[model samples]
Structures are given as C-alpha cells and as structure tokens.
Target: MFTKILIANRGEIAVRVMRTARRMGIATVAVYSDADAHAMHVALADEAAHIGPAPAAESYLDGERIIAAAKATGAEAIHPGYGFLSENPDFAEAVEKAGLVFIGPSPRSIRALGLKDSAKQIMEKAGVPVVPGYHGDAQALVVLATKAREIGYPVLIKARAGGGGRGMRRVDHPDEFADALAAARREARTAFGDDRVIVEKLIEKPRHIEVQVFGDRHGNVVHLFERDCSAQRRHQKVIEEAPAPGMTAAMRMAMTQAAVKAAQAIGYHGAGTVEFIVDAAKGLKPDRFWFMEMNTRLQVEHPVTEMVTGIDLVEWQIRVAAGEALPLSQNEIGLSGHAVEARIYAEDPACDFLPATGTLHHLRFPQPIPGVTLRVETGVRQGDIISAHYDPMIAKLVVHARDRKAALSALASVLEETEIAGVAVNTAFLARLVQNSDFVAGKLNTRLIPRHQQALTSFPEPETRTMATAALAASGAKFAPDAPDPFDAISAYAHFHPITHRRAIRHGDRTRYYAITGLGDGRFAVRSEEENAETLVLPAEYGERIVPWPGHLTIFDGPDNHTFQLHDPLEQAGLAASGSESLRAPMPGLVKLVRVAPGDKVKKGQPLLVLEAMKMEHTVCAPHDGVIAETVAEGARVNDGTVLVRFAESNTPNAGRPARRNIEPSRL
Candidate 1:
C-alpha cells in the first residue's frame, strides 16, 4: 500500500478517508480552504495544507494547487472524495502527470464517462439498454424541437455536460418546450459553461437504482449488489437502502451483470457506480430498467454497501491503488443484513427546503445500539461554523439491522436522539419519514416524498401524557415533611384561587401559553387550548436539566417524552424591516441571473431573481402583481437583506389602479 496519500477534498468524506487510511496504517494529508481552516478533517489528518481562499474555484477545484500540496507533503497518491475534483477528468490526469496516483478510476476511464452525451453513445455500443433520447450534436432550434416531438410528449431536457439535477427540465407538452429549453440552457451555461442539451423521454414514478462496481488492475471486476435511491427531493437523494426491499434474485442478477459489462467496456479500475432509472409504475423488473448515468467515483451512500457486505471499500481503493487485486470476488461478497442511510443536511424542510448556515452550538448522538451500528460521519464540532461557501450537508446517519423493518426502527430511534443546535436541520423530519406507514411498508418511489409532503412537514404536537411528565419533572423535588403544615407553602396561599402558571411552548405555527397545576409526587395536570388533559410524572432520578439546555423542557411520561422548544416572546417586538417596498436578498450570494429589469411588469409568483448560494439555486419570486421599479444587474454580489427590486403600483388601463403605497399590506 502507499505509505502516504493526499486527500483532495474536505468535509465528512475527507474525514471518512482519513479514518480508513488510519486503520490501514497509511498516512493521510488534508487540503482545506480558508472557510475550513478549523474543520475537523484538517485536525484529523497527519498533515494539512492551505490551498486557496474560501470559494471552491480558488481552492478545492484548483487542480494545480492540490497537486503542489500533494508533492510538497511527499504523498504518493491522492484520493478525491466524492464532490470537488472527484469526477473531474482533468484533475485525475493532472495528478498522474505529476507522478502521483489518483486513487480512483484511470483518467481514460473517467473521460469515457465524463460527458452525458458521449457516455450515452458509448453505452449504446456496449449493448446496455439506455434511455431513448436525442444524444446527437445538432443544436438548431427546429431540429431539437423535432427531436423532442419524435421522442414524444413529456420529454426531459438535460445539460450534456453536468449533473446534480442542474440544467435539467421536463416539458409535458409542445407549448412548454421552447421556454423550458431556453431556461435550461441559461442555467447550463451559468453552471457548467455548456449550453448543449439532450432530450429524453420522461419516466413517471421512476425508481433510481445504482449498482456498485469495483475493479482491479488485474482486469477483475465484481458487483456489490445495488442501492435503492428512490427517496428524493428536488432531484437530490434524502434516504437510501441496500439490497432493495422488493428486489428479486433474477432482477438483481441481470442488473449486476449489466453493471459488470459497463465496467469491462472501459477497462475500469477502483470504484465506480452505474446508475439506472427503473420504471416503478409497474414494479421493478429487469427489462424495465434503463441506464441513467455513471458516477465515476465513490458514492456518498457507500456506507450502506459496506454494512451489507463485510468489506471496507476505502481499504479496497487503497489496496487496488497499491497494485493489488480485489480482496474478494463476486461470490465472496454476501448481503448479510439490511442497511439504510439518511442524509442529515443543514437545511429547513418547511421553508422551501432552503439551505441554512450557522454555528453549531451543540451536536450529539446517543450511544450506539448493540446488534445495530449507527455511524455519524460529520466534519463540524460544537461552535464550528457552517459557511455558505460549501455544501450544507452536516453528516450521513447510517444504521444496520437484521431486516428492513428493524433498520427503519433503529434509524428512527437514532434520528430522535440526534440533537443539533444553532442550525436548523431535517432530523425530526427524517424520523417522521422512516416511521411513516407507507415507508415502513416499502411502497417507495420518487413520488413518495411528495405523496406524504404534508404529514412529513407537519410535526406532531406533544402528547398530553408527555406534557404532564415534563410538568412533574420541571417542578423538581417534591416535599412531604414529617412536621405539621408540611404543605404550609401550598396551604398558606392555597385557597384554590386558580393557581395558574404560564409557560411558553412551541408546537408548530406559533408559540402558545400552557397552564400548569401541580399534583403532588412530581406529577401535574397540564392543559393547552389545543391539547387534552394529560398527566405527567417526573423520573424518580431526575436532573434540573434533563435535556441539558435551559428555556426548553422534555417531559418523559409513562413511555414517551415531548420536547418543547421555547422562543423568547420579546424577539418579535424588536423586529424591524430594513428597506422600502423592494424585495431584499435573503442570503449572501452571487446573483446568478436577473430575470426582470428596472421597469418590467410582473405578476404574482413570477420568478424575479435567482441567487446561487451554497452551491444551489434559489429563486426569489414576486410577492404581488406590480411593475418592476428596480433590479440589480446580473452577477452582482449582495449581502443578506439587500433590496434588489422595488415594485410600483400597477396602472394598467383595463384594471383599476392598485391601492396607494402609503397603505401597508395589513391596512390594505
């Protein structure tokens, strides 16, 4: 094996690689940007180097800087973790040119599958079934429109040069084709600098299944089964599982063979994933699957494959890079148990799923369970900042159990105990999803999330029994002295004068007041306008702060507890609007595109501006029907709450004029 290797990435993946390298006695070097100077991965590596500034282009994506760092540290190989520079073919070639091994597929193999259009053509030659689409070089409007018609209605327009759900659009009919294509090309140019696109037939209720294939320099390749990544939102995977719940032996065999064939076509070595989109409308079958794309590096959900098969993929990557064959063959790898992984991101699920950035004041996971292992791979520690310069993923919460049901239960329990403060996360939302009846029954597809959107976003209110228990616990020690008038404090003032105590509790939309009545023995009866009467019992062995944070309380009733997050009532009184009628920027980011001008008229819900932040696109919409008063030029960098546009009261002749501007929204 290589004595020392440079990790050309950051975040949890860097930490993950360092861990495996440590286990195999290989020294690891980490590269970081200014934003990640204090990151956990940097501190964990044997040596660290600063590449450039905070932005990805200046640092992580700077191939020359990464290569220099690797050589300066005397590293023999570089492992590009899943995101930045992982799939960049030029980076792979650059590392090899510098006499350093890229611990992944060869540059030639990466280039073979680098571009979508070219990869599709290659797959067609290999006899692997591919989605019927126009992958030609023609760019004329009329020609592309004809191709869309030939493919049939409901065609998908995807950028030929990029992935990650960017530069992708679906047109359900001919009338929507022109605008969709224009918008897609604009985003494609902004994101990848390539405006070329391919049209494909859109599959409804598609289930995404990807086969994990690994090879060695000896030309030996084996498949590690497949993972079902059907649970998605906005084209991003949220939950994943290995040994698909409803997979049959015949289908698995066929998919595995196809995956191996694709690997052999490229003389691939190391790890790569061949993704296929299956038509789930009629359930999974061998013939119903078609090639989607190939991820030319290690996947984010690789842990699920590791949990099922008793093989460490990272160790294999190292051994293969060291000129060794795969440790195990296809037959040697066995799916012993089921594993599921939930991606815990630093984003809010309720508010358009916008990415959030803040300091992590508190982060903790409960003790791992026996017989089922819970792995939390994270890069941030308490008090560390989550910046907007990188991906907002906090960690991948994975669990393994004997069966799918057991895995779901274990995951739900772990998510509940996982506490993250300062930055809003989707932990509670994920817990609700795993415990959902439909999810437990394995009625899964891409639409599962949208089908259960309401229930998933709406959290359950605290149970009465749980509230009562919390009240009892919050009351602290109970007194019953042997002396007379032991209840003096209660009796002296206890004329049943409606002893009411107000405690603020938040459930969903708003925080409301709760009335408490102490019933002896650390028990109390609680009532809210929305809750029924419930009893609470304090734990026999309790602390002043069970949940370990003040201003909030978690009451363990008979068998459950409810956590009530408290909000300061005075915060709203101090709130002030910074600007005039113009809509302000909600976060710091570059203005990717300006859709409106200074005097363009727009309707409600129209897209007015687009901001690129945290490596994702967010659209700012018009709040009401009005004429545009002002707008920032494209590519302008703006801070949070910087007004970019102002609307004038509409004065269309047909329709009466809008009300006066002096009248605010509430008054109007």
Candidate 2:
C-alpha cells in the first residue's frame, strides 16, 4: 500500500476517504480552500495544504494547484472525492503524467463515459441496453429539435456533459421543446463549460436504480448489488436505499450483468456506478431497464450499499489503484440486511427547496437504536458555517435493519428526533416521506417527491401539547413518555396546588397563546385557540423533539416540526410604546429583579432592573429621570424591545395601547 495519499475534495466524502485510508495504515493529505480552512475534513487529515480561495474555479477545480499540493506534500496519489473534478478526464491524466496515482478509473475510461452522448453510444456498441434517444454529436439547435420530433413528444433534453438534474429539461409537448432546449443549453454551459445535449425518450414513470460495479487492473470485475435512488426532488436524489425493493432474482441478474458489461467495455478500473432508469409503471422487468449513465467515482449514497454488503468501497478503490486484484467475485459478495440513506441538506423544503446558509448553531444526529445501525457521515460541526459557495449538504444519515420495512420505520423515527437550528432543513420533510403511503409500500419513482410535493413539503400544524412541549424544552427540561416526570422545580406554591405557565407562540401565520397547567409527573393540561383544555400525553412511542435558542423555539411532534417566534408580554407592551426608550428591552433574557414600582420617581442612569442571560447579569438603567408610568412583571422572559417600564411624560404615547395588535409581515 502507498505510504500516503491526498484527497482533492472537501466535505463528507473527503472525511470518508481519509478514514479508510487511515484504517489501512496510510497517512492522508487534505487540500482545502479558504472557505474550508477550518472544515471538519481539514482537521481530520494527517497533513493539510491550502489550495486557494473559496471560489471553486480558483480552488478545488484548479487541477494544477491540487497536483502541486500533492507533490509538495510528498503524496503518492490523489483521490478526487465526487463532484469537483472527480470525473474530469484531463485531470486524471494529469495526475498520471505527474507520476502520482489517480485513485479512480483511468483517464481513458472517464473520457469514454464523461459525456452522456458518447457514453450512451458506447453502451449500445457494448450490447448493453440504452434508453432510445438521439446520442449523436450535433451542435445545431435545429438538429436537436429535429431529433426531438423524431423521438416523439415528451422527450427529455438532457445535458450531455454532467448530471444533478442541471442542464436538463423535460419538454412535455413540442411547443415547449425550443424554450426548454435553450434553457438546458444555458445551464449546461454554465455548469460544465459544455453546452452539448442529448434527446432521450422520457420514461413516464422512472425509477433511478444504479448498480455498484468494481474493476481492477487484472481485467476482473464484480457487482455489489444495486441502490434505488427513486426518491428525488428535481432529479436530485433525496433518499436512497440498497437492494431496491421488489427486485426479483431474474431482474437483478440482468441489471447487474448489464452494469458490469458497461464498465468492462470502458476498460474500467476502480469503483464506478452504472445508473439505469427503470420504467416502474410495469414493475421491474429484465427488458424494462436501460442504461442512463455511469458515475466515474464514489457516489454520495455509497454508504447504503456498504451497510448492506459489509464492504468498504474506498478500501476497494485504493486497493485497485495500487494494482491489487478484485477483492471478490460476483457470487462472493452477498447482500445482507436492507439499508437506507437520507441526505440531510441545508435547504428549506417549503420555499422551493432553496439552499440555506448559516452557522449550524445547534446540530444533533439521531442515536443508534436496537437492531439497527445508524451512521452519520458529515464534515460539519455545531459551529461550522454552511457557505453559499459550495453544495449545501450537511450530512448523510444511513441506517441498516433486518428488512426494508424495519429499515424504513427506523429511518422515520430517527428523522423525527433529528434537531437542527439556525438553518432550515428537510428533516421533517424526509420524516414524512419515509412514512408516506406510496413510499412505504415500495411504490417509488423519480417524480415521487414532485408528485407528492404538497403533502411531503408541507409541515403539519403542531398540537397544543407540542406548544407546551416547546415551552418546557426551552426552559431546559426533557420528557420521555414512559419516564416519570420530575418537574417539581418549575411548579410554584400558591393558592392553588399547581402552577400554570401561559405564553404566546407565533407559528407560521398565526399567533396563539397556550395555557400549560402543570399537573405533576411530567403531565400537563394544555389549551390553545378555540380548543378546550385537554390532558396532554405523548404516545409510548415517542416522536417529539424540542430545540430552543435565543428568541426562537422549534418543536417536532412526530411528522410535525415548526419554529415559533416566542412572544413575550413585554414585547407586546413594548411594541405599542412610543413615549420612552426605558419601556423597551435591551435583549432576550430573564427579568431578574424590578427595583421600582409604578409612579416611583427615578434618577437618570439609575439601575432599574437586572436581566440575566448566559449566566451573566445586565442591569437596565433609567433613560432619563422621570416618574414610572408602568412596569412589567418581574421574573418575566422577554425579547428585545419588550417593554420593561414606561416613564410618565407629556408624550405618554402608548400608555393605553392594547397589548395585542395586528402584526404584518415584511414583504419577502
């Protein structure tokens, strides 16, 4: 084995590759940009090199800089983790010319499969079935339009250069072909520097199934089963599972053999995935699957296959690059339990799935459960910033179970417990997806997410108990359905035997006040708008999580997750105040003590009240010497601009202002 290797990519994959390299006693080098200086991958590598700035063009994609970094670090090989320069044939050839190993397929193989058009042509010549379409190299838009006409309506205009649904457009009718072709070309050129495209007969109900194929220098190859990536949004995979549900022995044989044949024809070496589009309308059939394309490197969803087969693909990649023979034959590899992987992205599912960028102020992954293995592959920590310059993938959560049903159930529960703050995520969306009737029943397709957009993308409204849970979680308490509730500390001794905490929580377009009367033993009587007080009890099977931060709180009740803007009475009172600044709160914190009462004369700069946050004391002072017109209750939790006290003046502008007023949202 080589003494060391350099990973020329960032994020989870780079971290993933280094781990296997380390296990095999190989020291690894990492190359990073300014944006990834403190990235988790950088910290994990044995030796690191700074390539360039944040922009990929100036950094990760600059092959020369990467080669230089490897040479300077005395590394013997470079592993291009997927996405950036992973499938670039020239870069692979450059690595070989520089006397360093490229831990992937040879540059020749990449060249044969790099472009969708040429790859499809080669597949046809190799006797591997391909989707019927025009794979010719004609650049004229008129020519492409002609091919689209011949292929019939509903032809797909796909970017011949790269994948990820970019540079691809689905033209449902001839009238939409010209405009779609233009848009696809523009996207392709901007994304891959190649505007070339291919017209493929669109499979109406397509299931994206790809087989994991491996080859070595000795001309031997083996298949590691398949992964179903049919759960997608805009052609980008969201959930992927191994041993595709409902795969029969005959169909598996045909698809796996075809994948191997495609890889073998390219004179392939190392790891490669042959992706096929299956016509799911008629179910899996030997003749219904056709080759879509081949990925020249490790896939983001490789973990699912690894979980099912107990093979480390990265190890295989390194071994094959080191000229080792194939580890196992086709029959030697066996699939075990089913495994599924869900991509945890830093994006909002509600807002067109737009990418979100922010510091991961709070990030927590699900813990392993009985009879299931949970793996979280990530390169970000709690404080890491999700930058706008790169793909906004936070992590990949993989789980393995005895069967597909158990695996799906565990995944849903785990997703429900996932807590992420500061950036919107698809945690809730993915949770609902796994439990979706069609998905759980094994009815999947590329259009699954798009077809069920309304149901999957929409977050369910939280119940009154959920709001009560949010309040309790914010106060630093956790409740398990079966565990005895030990919440006496929050209960107050008054004329009554119990204490009720009333607070207003604003979620979505509505703000409702909840009354949570503690009844002891982790139970409460809760009431919300237009609802009577009901005994709140979480089912023995729990699907609840609460994450609280400054001025905000998030509650997850099974399939429901929502962030509430906590409304303090102080804030409601402060908003109506136009008389003095003292009525406004300085920050979100607890009102520790109120020194003066209403009508009390105070001197300018005198300490009014003590507010506490982060274990520190901050005293509110008098804005000017004046008589106090009103004072908020002591020991109240308040947000910024929450009215603390009002000064009596000629301009008692908001003394009688109603506490609740119609609040209009800012135009987005």
Candidate 3:
C-alpha cells in the first residue's frame, strides 16, 4: 500500500476516503478551493493545500494545480472521489504521467467507458446486453429525430458525456423532440462541454439495479452483488438498497457475472459500477435487464455495498493501484444482510427539489439504537455554511438490519429523529418514503416519487402544539436548571398567576394567532382559534436558534423544524415597507441565459431566464403578463433573491400611473 495519498475532491467523499486511508496507516492530503478553506475534509487530512478559487473550473478541475499539490505534499497516489475529476480520462492520464498513481481505473479503461454512446457500443460487443438506442456518430438534428421516430415515442435524449441526471430529457412526441433536444444539448454543453447526445428507448416502470465490480493489475476481477436504486426524483437516485428486495439467486448470479465480464473487457482495475435498467413488469429475469452505463469510479452509494459484503472498497482501490491481485474470488464473496441508504440533501421537495443554500446553524442525528446498525457519512458541522458553489447533498444515512422490513423500519425512525435547521431539507420526505406502503413492499421504480406525488410532496402544516412551543421559545422562555419545572421561573410572580401572551405565527400560506397562558408549576395552556385548547408541560428543545433582526425563533420537533417570526406592533403600524413586484433569483447561481430584453412584453408563466445552480438548471418565469422594465444580463453570478427582472404592469386602469418598483437587491 502507498504510504501517503492525496484526495482530489471535496465534501463527504473526500472525508470518506481519508477515513479508510488513515485506518490503513496511510497519511492523506486534502486539496481545497477558497470556499472550502475550513471544510471538514481539510480539517481531517494530515496536510492541506489551497488550489484556487471556488468555481470548480478554477480549482477542483485544475489538473495541474492538483498534481502540484500532490507532488509538493509527497503524496504517492491521488484518489478522485466520485465527482469533479473522477471520471475524466485526461486527468487520470495526467496523474500517471506526473509519477503519481491514480487510485482508480486505468486512463484507457476510463476512455472506453466514459462516454455513454461509446460505452454502450463497447458493451454490445462484449455480449453485455445494452439498451436499444442510436449509438451512431451523426450529429445532425434531423438524423437524430428520425432515429427517435423509428425507435418509437417516449425516447430519452441523454448527453453522451453526462452523469448525475444532467443533460437528459424525455420526449413524449415528435413535436416535442426538437425542443427537448435543443435543451439537452445546451445543458450538455454547459455541464460537460460536449453537445453530443444519444437517443435511447425509454423503459417503462424501470427499476435501476447496479452491480459493484472490482479488478486488479493481475487481470482478475470479481462482483459484489447489486444495489436497487429505484427511488428517485428528477432522474436522480434518492434512496438505494443492497441485495435488491426481490432479487432471485439466478438473476443475481447472471447480473454479477455480466458485470464482471464488462469490467474485464475494458481491462478495468480498481472500483467501478455497472448500472442496469431492469423491467420490473417482467420481474428480475436474466434476459430482461440491459446495461445503462458504467460509473468508472467509486460510487456515492458504495456504502450499502460495503454493509452487505463486509468489504472496504476504498481499501481495495488503493491495493489494486499498488498492483495487488483481487482480494477475493466471485464465489467467496457473499452478502450478509440488507442495507438501505438515503441521501439527505439541502433541498426543498415542494419546490421541484430546488437546491437550498444556507448556514447549518444546528445539526443533529439520531442516537444509535442498541442491536440496530446505523451509519452516517457527512462532511459538515454545526455553523458550517452550505455554499451554492457545490452539490447540495449534506449527508448520507445508511442503516442495516437482518431483513428488508427491519431495515426499512429502522430507516424511517432514524429519519424522524434527525434534526436540522437554517435551511430546507428533505428529511420529512425521506421518512414518508420509507414508511410508504408500496416502498415497504418493494414495489419500486424510477417513477415511485412521481407516482405518489401528492403524499410525498405535501408539507404538513405545523400543529397547534408546535406553534405554541415556538411562541414560548420566542417569548424568552429558556430551560432553567435551578427551577424544577420549565414554567417555574416564568410563573414565579404570584401577582401574574395566569399571564396570557398572544403571538402571531406564520407557516406556509396561513398565519394563526396563538394564545399561551402560564399556569404556574410546570404547566401551560395553549390554544389557537383553529384548534382546541390543550394544556401540557413545556417541550424540551432538541435544537434551537434565535435571530435578533426580525426576532425569529426556530425549534425542532420530531422530523419537522418550525420557524416563528415575532410579530412587531411597530412594523404593523406602518414601520415596514411594502413588498416588491419584480422577478428575483430563487437561489444563488449563474445567470446562464436571458430570454427577454427590457420593454419586451411577456405572458404569465413565460420563461424569462435560466439559472444554473448546484449543477441543475432552473427556469425563471414571468409572474404575470407584463413588459420588462429592467433586466440583468447573462453570465452574471447572482445571490438568492437578487432581482433579475422588473416588470411594468400591463393594460391596467392605472396603466399611465407610475408603479412602485423595488428592483434593488436586498441582503438577507
């Protein structure tokens, strides 16, 4: 094994690699950008080096800078952890040329499996069944459209050089093909700098199952079962599980054999994943599965494979890069138990899962239950800022149990006990998914989330008790150890036996007045006009944060976090300013495209601009039919709520009158 290695990545993956390297007595170096100067991975490494600015192109993607840092730190190898430069063939070749071992597949192997079109063709030749699609080199639109028509409707246009669901679109009809293709090409160019795309037949009710394979320099390879990653949103995997729920012995054997063959055909070494699309409608049969593509590095969902097989993939990667033989043969490798992993992201499920950025003022995870196995992989700490310059994934929650039912149940409870504040998260959504009947029964597919949209997307309204608790916290109620009861300190005054405090709390689109009365001792009576009165003891705080500006208080209850703003009488009495009527950027991102100019008329819901954030494209639309009075130019980096377009009210009775416009950006 190498004595020291450098991790050429950031976030949880970097931390994950370091953990294994340290356990194996290998010192690790970390490279960071300006934005990640104080990142968790940097703090964990034996040594750290600054590469460049925050943008990936300037730092993480700068192969020269990374090589220099590795050489300066005397690192014998470099591990590209799953993103950024992980799958880049040129970067792999560069590392080897710099006299440093690249802890992954050979550059030649990467090139053979890097592009989707090329990889598909290679798989077909290897006798690994591939999805039927046009893998030709023609780049003309007409040619691609004709191919799509011949393949039938509902074709998927995927970027030849894409991963993580970027640069992909599904066309349902011939008329929609042109628009979808144009959008796919644009996104592909922006994401991968390649505008080439391949058209494929869209499988219905497809379950995504992938086999984990490993290889060594001695030309030996083996497979590690499979993982079912069917639970998804926006074409990205949300939850993944190992030892696919309904997988049969015959099916598993065939898939694993094919996966091993795929790896050997490319002379693949180190860790890689061969992803397959299974037609659930026909069950997991050997002939019913087709190769989608291969991930040429360690996967984000590798933890589940580790839990089931008792294997450390990172350790294998290092040993193989050092020219070691395969750790175990295919016959000796076996799965022990079921494991499930849920990706907890800083995103809002209600708003099309748009990525959210903010400070993690408070972060907490569930305490481990005895006899139950649970693991959390994260690279963030309390008070760490989740920046918009990187992926929004905050952590990965993995749980293992004797059976699928037990694992599913444990995962739901774990999610319920997890607490986070200062930003939107998908904890509640994840909890709902684990507890969902269909999901529990293993009736899963890529469309699971969309099929249960209403149940999974709706955010529950804050309960009356939750609002009352927030009101109490906001009203200067703190946990006092000297007083036996929580209300003892506040109710000490005999003259104020039944003090009543009224506060207005807003949740979602509704605001309700809460009347909380202290009943001495440790009890309090809380009531809302919309609900019945309930008397109870003060709830203990799991997490809390107080902001002085608008007197906002946030409290955690189960899986839900509630924020209440203290109503100001002065603001209600004309001290506060009116709202604005302009289009604002929903999140911090780069303005990729501006579709309208000043004074141009646009209809309601018309696309006005596209903002690229967290590696996803979000289109901003006009709120109403109006003329653009002012607008920002393309290629501008903007913060959240930065006004991008100001509108002039259209065809109103006061059309000639000047309207109050607040186009200036406001600091939060």
Ranking by TM-score: 3, 1, 2
**Residue clash pairs of candidate 3:** none
RMSD to true structure for each model, in Å: 6.5, 13.5, 4.7
Q: Report every candidate's CA lDDT.
A: 0.78, 0.81, 0.82
What TM-score does candidate 3 get on C-alpha atoms?
Answer: 0.91
Candidate 1 is scored at a TM of: 0.84
Indicate whether candidate 2 or candidate 3 has the larger lDDT.
3
TM-score of every model versus the real structure = 0.84, 0.78, 0.91
Off by over 4 Å in 3: 478-489, 492-502, 509-517, 525-551, 567-576, 598-603, 624-627, 650-668
User: Which is the winner by lDDT between candidate 1 and candidate 3?
Assistant: 3
Off by over 4 Å in 2: 468-505, 511-544, 567-668
Query: 90, model 1: CA deviation in Å?
Result: 0.9
Candidate 2 pairs with clashing backbones: none
